[model samples]
Target: MIEFRRNIVAGTAVLVVAAVSGCAPGTGDRAQPATTATGTSMVTSPTAVPGTLVYLDVAAGRPITMTTVTDGAARRTTFGTATRSDEHVLVPSPDATRLAAVESPDPDSVAPGDLVVISAGGARHTVATKVMWGGGSAPVWMPDGQHVIAAVGGQWRVIDVANGAATPYPAGPRPGADGGYLTWSTNGHWRAIGGSTDVTVTAADGTGEVKRSVASLPECREAAGCPTSVQAVSDDGRYVALGHMNSDPSRVTEAHLVLDMRTGGLVNLPPTAPGGSVDRVFFRPDGGMVVRTVTNDGRYTFVLLRADGSTLATLPDTTQQHPSGRNLVTYRP
Candidate 1:
């Protein structure tokens, strides 16, 4: 599932507080020097990097729109009418040359959905498929842009853009187990499946090997207790961010973790806020950091962290309408 921002307001305020404790130094003469408070500190208006565009699904009757923020200024750009479904909006290529989105003509057509590749030059190509469910989520592009990994039917499939052919991977347990939810490592050697009974990874070659399982992780529940959910793997494939949903599917809780794919060791992330769940995870262009979100009340906060689970920065809160609904957030590398 793609992570999206819900509401976009003009501006918001973030408050930082510093704590101080009173104490006395042992001693003497009648008066002791005043001890200065040190340690905890709060920084307001932390400068954030510019040039990041967040595609938001606003409530106003339109499809989807782009919200760009540079420094502290914000602008909105209209990108034509988008698919009305809840699928994610694809991020354009690094050069903004091409964009890949999942388009469905109707709700019930067999090959209802197609991969719509749009170029900045205005050329378009529609790659239709029958192997997977047309109503599946957005398509993720490989580094070369010649291949896209998407979930169709109940399995993961890779589409060769050259000829529009799709090759399906082995099906994980469960009916309607569409691998529609997936995360691709930046190196292209590994891919992770979200919304499964167990967190599964496979080789990019369709080798069908189960590289790791979430059940074996320290905190993941077994098949009987595991909740149906989605996860995002880091660009380097070193971390997997999993979202846990309640049985009713109305609420979700997220845990950010780093797993050594080679060893299956897991590291839990420190809490970002008291309450709120993770929306999605995406690696920064440089692959040195990953971006994730924590939603509390009706507001969403974006966090940038190192691969090892250290917090780098927490962006200002942005307003959102629905906290339970899925939102897509993509990084342009």
Candidate 2:
């Protein structure tokens, strides 16, 4: 039993608010733990991804623990009793009932290893520990929460959580000639295959493929180098966040764009907030943008942007995000 920092937190917003497990925080970052409120007003579309909980191992130890700030307090749960710390990647199942971590015993090497699946209740299991290696790749959960997917050795495989069995997964996209990443839309209907030169979006079931080059996207190409790649897709699969980084820091600041996947339209986004550079971006179920910014000094902030690329709220003293996508969670030591 380990103690984690508070998940449920209150904070200063641009009128932003934070919460945990359906409970809202008080008025500031130091808000004390409060009794949980019952009921959730969260409405979901038929295609909405059901997020169970925001979880991962914040630290490694004998009894591996995953935590989240819930109800204005830290909530730590033991999910890894005997799991090895060398397993560098920690991914939570979409349903939050289990976790997937690389079971690599050698921390220094990026060699293949078995992948372990540990239930939130502390049940540990695996399929191919020595077959997959870490190349900055992570296990991703499908929106349905029934399967876990990973790209191994440039090939893709899907694991059925129920039986710990795996089979080849036909992820649509030729391997990038110059290294790339595979990301899923929030609803799991769209897969974004991004590389240095181009990006392709296609249906998860392998249909409706659209490919665009870095030079073709607006504000990229000759103007600001090239659109690096799409960082995140909106939950509704209507918008995507694209980024372009400047090679020469003195000449260009990082540039970002919100591309409408439905209409091929592009909207520029603000690259910086109070904290620092925007480090991460995700779309809320309602098509709002959840932007996490990190300053040069290492502090973090969560800013919410409307669908039209306007700031909805700037949450202060927030770090970790709730998996529910509605609020940001603050962690206090």
Question: lDDT per residue, candidate 1, 35-64, as tens digits?
Answer: 442221112223563334344443323534
lDDT of each: 0.45, 0.49
How displaced is residue 138 in candidate 2, in Å? Answer: 2.6
TM-score of 2: 0.64
Q: For model 2, what is the error of residue 176's alpha carbon versus the real structure, in angstroms, after optimal superposition? A: 5.1
Query: What TM-score, to 2 decimals, does candidate 1 have?
Result: 0.59
Ten consecutive residues with minimal summed lDDT in candidate 2? 1-10
State in Å the error of residue 304, model 2: 1.5
Please list the residue runs of candidate 2 whose C-alpha ends up more than 4 Å from where it truly belongs after superposition. 1-57, 69-74, 81-87, 152-154, 174-180, 215-231, 236-238, 242-266, 271-275, 317-333
Q: TM-score each candidate.
A: 0.59, 0.64
Q: What is the C-alpha RMSD of each candidate to the true structure, in Å?
A: 14.4, 12.8
